[model samples]
Target: MNAIFGWSVLALVFLDELLAVAAFGVWGWDRDPRWLLVWLLPIAAMTVWFLLASPKAPYGGPVVRPLAKVVVFGLASLALWDAGHEGWAVALLVFSVVVNGLALLPSIRVLVEEG
Candidate 1:
């Protein structure tokens, strides 16, 4: 279970990064230079924050922190998607939710186990 959780978290991280890159690329092609920076800053900040906060690798610990971060990022993506109304933004929002949902699975499992 720990191994699965670890790999799933890794996958979510990978997907999140990939989507971010894709969003930047699309923004560049669309000639919206500002969005490239906009998309990167938050992700970079979150990556740093996550690394610092989970220094001991807290995947198997309580789920609240991870869930909170996921919710925040998911909402941010959704807001961007809604604001742009572009296909790429929509795709990014969907990808964010799915990846975050996968990341949340371990927490959900923990909740079930506790009950």
Candidate 2:
């Protein structure tokens, strides 16, 4: 049961990250082809690590690290949106980042047995 929930949460995290990357690629970066590869590399690396590490539940150092990645991606996305003069894109990206972060926080609490 815990394993299933953990995996589900992990999948959500991965999906959120992918959406962020894609958002950055499309709206934020002005659909730059080169930027797509650059944006995907860290996600690919994280996917590999997640598969190999095989956590029973989403806790510990690794879970926290992904949040940082999300923040970085969000900031980069904001910067790109600003560069492109897209105000709506910036708001949407920021909202996504906040929502993803909030979703992950509950899982962290569960993992830590704090709630």
Candidate 3:
């Protein structure tokens, strides 16, 4: 049961990351200079993910890692809201909180640390 929940949470984290990038894309779609923003925003978001959120990221450390997650997810949620996806924005925020909360549980954390 612990392993199952851990894996599920991990999968959800991946899904959240993808959804954040998509949310940025959605926002860029409606802005001026669509050609640039449509591609650029997601690229920037991915760069941040690679630098501060990935498992092997160098700059994350302890504080910066969680802070980066908050910044990325927060911006993504705001982007969704700004792009007329109010419900989706709220849902994404709520989903992130719940998923991260679950992942931090001792049982799941143990599985992750061991694996």
Question: Global lDDT of each model?
Answer: 0.54, 0.53, 0.89
Candidate 3 lDDT, 1-115, residue by residue in tens:
5677788998898898999999999999999999999989999999999999776687876788788999999999999999999999999999988887787788877776676
Name the TM-score of candidate 3.
0.92
lDDT of 2 by residue, 1-115 (tens): 3645655555665665555555544443444565675566446545543544223334425765565565555654664575574675576566656655654565553653542
Cα TM-score of candidate 2:
0.41
Enumerate clash totals for all models, in the order shown.
0, 0, 0
Instruction: Quote model 1's TM-score.
Output: 0.42
Colliding residue pairs in candidate 2: none
lDDT of 3 at 31: 100
In model 3, state the lDDT of residue 54. Answer: 72
Per-residue lDDT of 17-60 in model 1, one digit per residue for the tens? 55654544434444446567556655654564355423243442
**C-alpha RMSD by candidate, in order:** 6.7, 6.8, 1.4
Q: How does model 3 fare in lDDT?
A: 0.89
Candidate 3 clashes: the total is 0
Could you tell me every candidate's TM-score relative to the true structure?
A: 0.42, 0.41, 0.92
